[model samples]
Target: MDIQKDQILETRVRLELDAKDLRNYAKKATGYSFALEDIAEHLESTVELLKSIEKLKSQEEQDQYQIGQQVVYVDEFMPDTVEIITSIVDGWVSFNNGSRGCIAVMIRPANQDEIKANKRLMVA
Candidate 1:
């Protein structure tokens, strides 16, 4: 069987099972018992994270900038930087330096067009 197809079928079967049934199936399959509550909690957290991502996607479709919004900037040679919007004046935006007693850094706001042209800038 194709590995990707097998994974899809396995995921479908797992999604159909209830919390109790999933715990029993896990025990029988792996010989290790897992708490139903723990499984349910994990599933809930995963769903919540998905919902959050969806919300962020919709917000990104609308506008990337809002006062006090948090966004992540992707960097090619370094780790992604997370910054909070501190102020916006004209077409420029200022982000908190993420350091104690540091001044905010100002940069021109990148609109959707700019983001489409340059993939490095992103809004989380």
Candidate 2:
């Protein structure tokens, strides 16, 4: 079954953290079988597979945006804010304010109207 990329990323992060903890426990536990270490290795390998499955933004999507392009960012706590794309890291859109997340989900290319409105606000 298909899992969302964000979900996969979150699960991979949690699994990696758990695997680190398991390795630490294995190191501290005396007279224990290698089972814990083996399990940790399995979890780590699973994380690798998850990394492979997690989808990055497509080349087409990347080409549609540029470092100086403007975008409208929206999150649960705030209204749409016009921001510049400062960078794109591994297909994730980064904004001038140092905020970044899933593009088109929380951010999108700002239309001409929005950009013009923001420019007017800045001039006011």
The number of the candidate with the highest lDDT is 2
- Cα lDDT of model 1 overall? 0.47
Query: How many collisions per candidate?
Result: 0, 0
Using alpha carbons, what is the TM-score of model 1?
0.28
Candidate 1, residues 1-124: lDDT per residue as tens digits? 3233234445544544554466666667643444655775576555555555544544443354676655444334532344556764433445664331112222324455544554335432
TM-score of each: 0.28, 0.49
Consecutive 10-residue window with the lowest summed lDDT within model 1: 99-108
Mark the 10 consecutive residues where model 2 has the least summed lDDT: 115-124
Best by TM-score: 2
